[model samples]
Target: MYERQNQRHVPGHTFSTPELAWAWLRSEQTLIDRGEWTPPATRRQEQEAQAQREAETSTPFGAYARDWIANRTTPRGTPLAPRTVSEYHSYLEGPLADFAGRQLADVSRADVKAWWQRFADKPRYRHHAYAFAKSVYKAAVKDGLLDANPWDIDNAARVVLQTPKTVRATMINDLTPEDVQRVADATQPEQWQALVLLLAWTGLRPGEAFGLQRRDIKTSYIDGIPCWRIHVARAVSRSRTPDGIRVDTIGTPKTPESIRHVWLPPHLVPAMEDHLDRFSQPRAEGLIFPSTNEALPFATTQQVAGTTGKQRRDRTGGKVRPPSGFNGARESIGMPGLRLYDLRHWARRILLSAGMGELAVEQYMGHRLPAVQGAYAVLDPRQVWPVMLRCSDLAGWTPSAAAPAGRDTAVLLNEMTAEQLAAAVSAMSPDQLAVLVPTLSPEALVRLLGTQGRP
Candidate 1:
């Protein structure tokens, strides 16, 4: 009970949101309306009986592993992703076979830890081995086969190969405004121009950028100025077949937090418009970067000859190698070793330079953190568009507010976000907020109003 509380793990009764809580209550209400639902009298007895039955017929780890994985389900109640299932099978067969023939109930924390120590040198699969052990033992507890999980040992998670120095070079030396224009000028086939802008300008992951569709782009008002709101809900993934063809899977983003909206600068709209006018399909549902022949919208294939080409060395010695549009663009800009990911790294710096907060940056980057942080602040385009546009403001590319306000500074200030306004108001305290008559975010301003009534 203490362990469960420490992990913040709760049984399926109440959920995080009012909507989910209501749904749960409604479900019980429906069951009660059916006349067959009632509170159980012998809950402990029933649990004890089930446990006794499980103990009577001891199951081996190999067989139990199969059953455990087969029953595993995702958050939305869908079956686990194919890639996830495949990895689980691989771990069971390779690093976790020591307990295969042993009784599932008899497996100890010591055995799981010893197996983890043996595989910790690989670095990549170090955490995976520990995770699999925790999962199997956790499943056993849930299935009434064990009172507690044997694989919750903390020492099992420490990987010997991990080091702070192994990280990539610091992203401090970021791309500049002039550097961006040069790269944009060099992109060929014309369509790649917007692709270049989307990557460098927006902090979207490569897969997220590649998976963008025409319909995902929408326009909305931010601080009374119209801006583009790019809906980022999905990403592209690839898998290689036995016959050697690479297939693309259009799935949900890497995590739930990754499903977010990004605000592109108003000046950048024309570039998107120009790219869509020429490259994107006529229909709204078409991919922005479809294959040349237009058969596969989110994918293209590479031949075996190209895969084993003597002209170059492989990035990962694997399949599904797509031609890079940025590699050629790099030489045109006179900058080499500037990777596609560098653009995203530089974007964070640009936002920070523009006075955007770390929380705002993390939200825009779609970084996964604890669930509580998301509840207080759900950043809409109105809150994040202006922050992102500040970098473009550096280029003197004023398209929206260029005419509305005489000075560019006034235009940008007028475009200050609801969150920014809220934060500013909150920092000013009661005396300052009293003098400021501007209409602010009601959620934040209500507290100020209440404080104004106080001494």
Candidate 2:
């Protein structure tokens, strides 16, 4: 029988979580007091009997791998994005199949080495094979089918290549003031324009933008300072089901820090104020940018009312207008070339180059960290004027030079009305919209309305 506790117990061998360790220790002590336990059987006959039963009843590696993947699903209950278990099944069904019938013990170091050799032969398959095998072993270990993982041995050749003479430009395109105006001007769609403007100014990710709502913005003053805050609540993702049907969904922001509040520039503040008037919906449907259905924000390659016209005409037996509009917007605007995410990259580059501290930008961008010490405290838009002015200069945007110095600041707001702005947004092509939308702040939208001067 085992003693109450080992006389020479290692100092650090206890569990990391006290609750777990204490419970395990209590059970072990009870067993010792009653003399009812002994060390587990390690005999050859015992091993053989266990092996015989497992071989007779244990699931095949391919089958087990699939079931294990299904049971260990994440909150989304889907396999890891960018990968799948069916692919794992293929590997086991092929080269790894021989070991499927053999007991887990029969698999040895030599067998693992041989499989690695075969896996390494195909460069494209090599990474996947290595990852798949590791996952298989891990699952088997959890199920008590293996004593220890032999695949942990690091015995593989490394691949290497030289850096290029000149690195291609990263996502940071080093945009000029004229470049920003040209892109904005070239963009004809209002929603796309707003989306682009948000990226050019605030650095919000495409998915985050897609998930935005009118309520998330808190435009209020603390003490005497004017501040503009954006509270990130959620993001959009796309997935395909087992039947090959595609679905789009929204979930909470990727990380805790991603749920952040960003300060706006005072100049941009007017633009945002005007932007609210322009895009603010009376109902929840008043998303800054809604999917064609007007129920959710935008997603790519989605078929929106692709056959609504035909279906409508068939049902009415006459020329009937469709319930939803045509499905050609995303492709019509040249959005395929400039991914939705490029706006975010462009925003970071603009802010970082204009002298915003790394921590401030990171905080504004919602990057998660272990601690909050390195982050900037939330502040008002007026506090960010220097950075914002530099940003406007970088983007080639200039507020009206003719507004009198003493007039109400609102008089010089963008020259566009909310209705005209909405019309502008509704008329632009997707690509044009992408570039134009990101530039639309409350102040910018008002200025665009021809409200450039006072009475």
TM-scores, each model vs. reference: 0.58, 0.52
- Model 2: CA > 4 A from native: 1-45, 52-57, 61-133, 139-173, 187-190, 220-228, 264-285, 293-298, 301-339, 370-386, 398-455
Quote model 1's TM-score.
0.58
- Scored against the true structure, residue 62 in model 1 reaches a CA lDDT of 75
Cα displacement (Å) at residue 292, model 1: 6.6
CA lDDT of every candidate: 0.62, 0.54
- Tens-digit lDDT string for candidate 1 (56-171): 43888777876777888887587876556666766766677777778877777777667656765675685886687688777777766688787876755665543232232342
Model 1: ten consecutive residues of lowest lDDT: 301-310
The model with the greatest lDDT is 1
Could you give candidate 2's per-residue lDDT for residues 147-170 as a string of tens digits?
776566474434321322222134
**What overall lDDT, based on C-alpha atoms, would model 2 receive against the true structure?**
0.54
The regions of model 1 sitting more than 4 angstroms off are 1-62, 73-83, 93-121, 141-169, 172-193, 219-226, 238-247, 254-257, 291-297, 300-345, 367-373, 378-380, 383-385, 395-455
